[model samples]
Target: MPSLELDRYLGTWYQLAAVPQFFNLVCARDTMATYALDPQGNVSVRNRCTTWMGTPNEISGTATVNDRVTGAQLHVSFPGVPTQESLEGPTNYIVTALGDDYSWALVTDPSRLSGFVLSRTPALNEAQWQQIRTAIEAAGQSQCMYLTSPTTGGLSGIAPLCTV
Candidate 1:
């Protein structure tokens, strides 16, 4: 696993593609997530997306670093959500791949059932997209077929190769 520089990783990230989650099913476009380092060293997470009804939906959560040495594993929890009691352990979120300049990242859970391709901008270049796809495969996840391309109006209107 690669180590993550918390400072560099903190900021707004657009979701270029992701395996569909029930909670995000309502999202139609402009999906994004933001991370901020809290005073206590924990990370505050805020996710937002344009809903199918043309409204914005947002959720706030918190993530704690599970391994200081690597800083790639995280235990994330949304308020009032029973993530801790779920079958998967709390440390499910991991930074599987990170761009050298903190421009993009690939994140997945321990079960490989959840994954996200995130970028600093709404779209990634051809080379960046290729790198992210390769990283997703390397992470042992095959459900890329379920990834939905967010329409943030930045990629020359190119459709995602994956089928939703």
Candidate 2:
């Protein structure tokens, strides 16, 4: 399968939804992600959020493109924490799909075991969401496990999976 193109992939992206991950557990509102080139030429990640009770939190990290042949693959770690405090295992971040206008993206991991749907806007239309769902399934991931993005009212309703 083709990997995500790096240059075209850099920019601010809104988190549409994702599986529950440790790093994001405390994030309760308006979560978003931004990617940029660092001084050393690595991908920089900025994740921001608001607590459930309305406190703001932010984290910054740097990611290295694992395979230039497939720039879609990356290994990321937070800069705020010491290397010893980094994740015990490397997190695989793979880009499975990209929007035609670079307005949205579908990201899965190496095993297609976990993933997220992101966009430039807080909400996505049925068509765009369906496209993400299709890509997730085709990649062998479980769409049923996808939780709702808090961007849409703080996760009150169940996240409906797209049916073919």
Give all candidates' CA lDDT scores.
0.79, 0.75
- Per-residue CA lDDT of model 2 for 87-146, tens digit only, reads 334547878887777777888887776778888888777777778888877888778777
Task: Give me the displacement of residue 161 in model 1, in angstroms.
Answer: 4.0
RMSD of each: 2.9, 3.2
- Mark the regions of model 2 whose C-alpha exceeds 4 Å error after superposition: 1-3, 80-91, 152-164
lDDT of 1 at 98: 87
| Candidate 1 deviant stretches above 4 angstroms | 84-89, 155-160
Clash list (residue pairs), candidate 2: none
Among these predictions, the greatest TM-score belongs to 1
Model 1 clash pairs? Answer: none
TM-score, per-candidate, Cα-based: 0.88, 0.84
